[model samples]
Target: MISSPERGGTVSTPTLRQILRDQLAPADPRILCGHDRLDVPVRWVHSSEIYEIGPLLTGGELLLTTGLGLRGLDGGTRKHYVHDLAERGVAAVAFEVGRTFDEVPDEMVRAGSAARLPIIELRSVVPFIDVCRAVNTSIAAREVDELRMRALLDDALHDDLAAGAGVAPMLGHLADLLDAPVVLVTAAGALVSAHGVDDDSAAWRVVDRAVAEVPVRSRGRSLARLVVGERAGAPTVPYAEALLRAAAGPVSVGLTRAGVRGSALAARLVEDLVDGRPLRRADLETRLAGAGVTVGGPSVLVPLAAEAPDPRMADAAVAAAAFDSMARSIVDATVYALVSVPVGGPGDVDPVERVASGLARSTGLGRTTIVVGDPVGIDRSRPGADASRTLTDSLRRCARQLGLAASAVSPAGAGRRVHTAREMLVDEAIGTLEPSVRAELSALAAPLAAHDERASTELVRTLAVHLAHGCSATRSAEVLHIGRQSLYQRLERIRVVLGFDPTEPSVYASMMVALRSLAAGA
Candidate 1:
């Protein structure tokens, strides 16, 4: 039997054509059938007389045997044997004629032709051991060549790392080696770096095909994914998998270093603005311009809140870089950006919404809240001026709204109501009502709160559900997953505890406001 290299390494056995054309084997090996499949690779060589050998194969085998096992077998049995070998993906069947039958069986030839399984006839002069030796020698030569190529690739990557070259050079080198496009992306699918490709190309079709994705990790956490597209006339599958595995480590190191440096720069800039530090207008403008943001004219402050924290800000950075906006993380779960709206631009095109949509698509954060503030000029000379203060206040208010939205089971109902600048400002003002007024509102729900705390009852939730369903017992019961009798009993208990008329309009309005105020942490 031919000895093959270990699986999942940069080595592959020779194909069927190589074995026939090379001088290592006997001079006149003949293909009896299925000549079209001469290029299939021969993974191994096996010799067996057992007819039930289909269960023993792992595919891509060149099987050799004599006709001893098929001496008394009928025509149907002979055809069945060849069909079984074909179904098991045996690369080719080589039979020696002198051992049993005078010539090859016609039934076996027709079955091999039908299944497209290459059938080769070996003359009496060539021993079976010679065939095995030739195949093994070819596999050994392939392994040696793979070792040399792998060394060259490793040295190239080492040189890049030593020279402080960034991710682009690494990816470009990898693309040249594979002869196909390569892309690096965050876990959320934001593009980090790409080489030898464009956004619109047929190579992107490989993203949805049998893609080879390798994870890039740092400090025990995954930072990004390296994707290698399929190349035409590439090596075997195991060799490709090994190559990707080799490339992932250095790519991860480069990405992590670059990400840390970028995050530090962005954090300092954002922290200064949030804390209202004094700075020259020219300096601010220069920094913003470097990031592709034009802040000389009118600009709007856009605050974005995510349901979870993205520590590296990789997704947001990609989105911001794409739209030529300035983005920085203000908190663990919130980021703020400034986007320019051209003067005399069409009113119908809302730049804030466009930025928000782009970020949502990139970050894959479905419940993100994007709040837009009124336009303010960056030319204001004084630190903590009215314009800067307003922008900062709007950011804080937007952050509060995000927290409120995340706590609710369904944020789409009330969270979506705070869209415009005026609505956000009004909500902020209303949220800061006098302590005495808040206390007065709190008294409206004191009874239900006490009962819920003491008896572990759902009185507050029941009241909210009842009010939400327009005080309809039937509808509320369905929503609460309780029977009609149980819902009525709970409503009667609520009325008794509050000492109020159950159907009074004035009482209902007061209780609704009190519930909202308590939920808002008033």
Candidate 2:
């Protein structure tokens, strides 16, 4: 953070009404339109005689002009000029009329009203340079006052720290000082604590739309970020930002002294979700914050659950690697982790693969299986219950696949221990079927099973191989070491007994699952 000359207080931006009420306002000013919006703050003062100067502006400028460019313009052109200025977010337009026109144009006034832009008519012959100087000087003075106020506030917060105040109390004090909701979110965007916020979702909303945000760091690593809202009732965002920046030093110092251990808390959070335990929104937010895993504001969560002879290998892998945000907890003999990666970042890097490799390496030359469930996309705008439900449901789904992924972890060899739930997604889905549903699917292949048992014909095996090779008669015959004509004959007899063509796409899919389910049950 840039060093401030002093610590905590705030000065509001100078508005047009405030300026007009004082001697800094231009002489002989008359409100032509938009009188109700005089509270708009002036960022800077600019004087332009060129008619097409709107595009050159960068919003919030108080445009001053002697009307030299509006002389004899057509009605449409004058309206367009007014519209251009308004659309560019100029705070207000001060038009001097004696040199170019007797009064402000009716077309311009109507356009200003239509755009909700303030138009001030200068009836006297006022020099544009003097007006710019006086207004700019006032703006600069207010900025200095704002900085001084922020320094005072910062100092007060340090005093709070000296008085044995914790982070939560300091947040409350900050909220009282600013008269707004204040929150602390981890760098990953998880809520640590909040003041003036009602619940978990509201805290996230504050983070999502925070007008002022400052990072608090210890020894060059981020500890947390301080957020302030615009609803302070009086403090502008600029002033709030200045105060927060100054406050970060004390916040960092406090966090270091408090010894915030994020990794352990994060790990516990991931385990709880997978254990099918319901967690409150506040509890969830706090734990996720501790783990440095963010589920808010465009953050996507990927849950990975693993078991191994030694879970420390997996723990070491995550601990040693450079993941932006990851939390690991060893629950029983299994380690559960929730990794956060940004959306629309490097799409080529598969998170599942990245985490799988880490786990595989951590348990090198040992028995370990890692299963990454479906990627859960968190919508921060949802209600607290809805967000919490989404997280719990996703993790539970991942938990259900643990048994299956574990069974198939060493498909290639014992060395190939890491696998994604997606590799067996179809089977994972099949495993979720109700017991009666699975029985019905298994029954579909019962006739073949019986035929093979009674006649010793190997029909079930024939059908399994045939469908597994996409109904390729030649490949089926080669694999079964049977005559081509015999394979065809058996396939025809099997179709007749099954009462449907097995090669049809939908029937093929059903039969494939049925055969697998039948084999699994057996």
- Measured by TM-score, the strongest candidate is 1
Number of clashing residue pairs in every model? 0, 13
- RMSD per candidate (Å) reads 19.4, 20.2
TM-scores of all predicted structures: 0.42, 0.40
- Lowest-lDDT window of 10 residues in candidate 2? 406-415
Error of 2 at 57 (Å): 0.9
Model 2 TM-score relative to the real fold: 0.40
Estimate the lDDT of model 1.
0.63
- Tens digits of lDDT, candidate 1, 1-522: 111133233445678888777632563667899899999988777778888888899899988887778888999999999999898999999887777877789889999999999888766556667778778776777767556556666777778778767567877766666556677755533345677676624434555553477887765656567777766555234355555667778776665443322345555655456556645666766665665556765564454433232323433443433555555543322455455555445664565565555554554333344444545456555555555455566555554554444334221134342243433443345468897887787788778878999999988778877886789888888877899999888989998998985457877767766766665556
Candidate 2 per-residue C-alpha lDDT over 1-522 given as tens digits, one digit per residue, 9 for 90 to 100 = 123332365446678887666633446789989998899888888899899999999999988887888787899999999999999999999888877888888999999999989998877666778767877887787777766666667766778779745466667666765667889864433345688888967887888888888888865666478999767454455567766777787766654442212355775676567556776666776777766787566666777765442345445544544567877665433456677766666565676676666555652424445667656665545554455566667655554555555454221221355667675566666768999998998899889888888888877777888887878889989988898999999999889878888778878888878876776562
- Any runs in candidate 2 off by more than 4 Å, and if so which? 1-10, 24-26, 141-238, 241-522
Off by over 4 Å in 1: 1-12, 23-27, 144-166, 172-242, 245-522
Q: What is the C-alpha lDDT of each candidate?
A: 0.63, 0.70
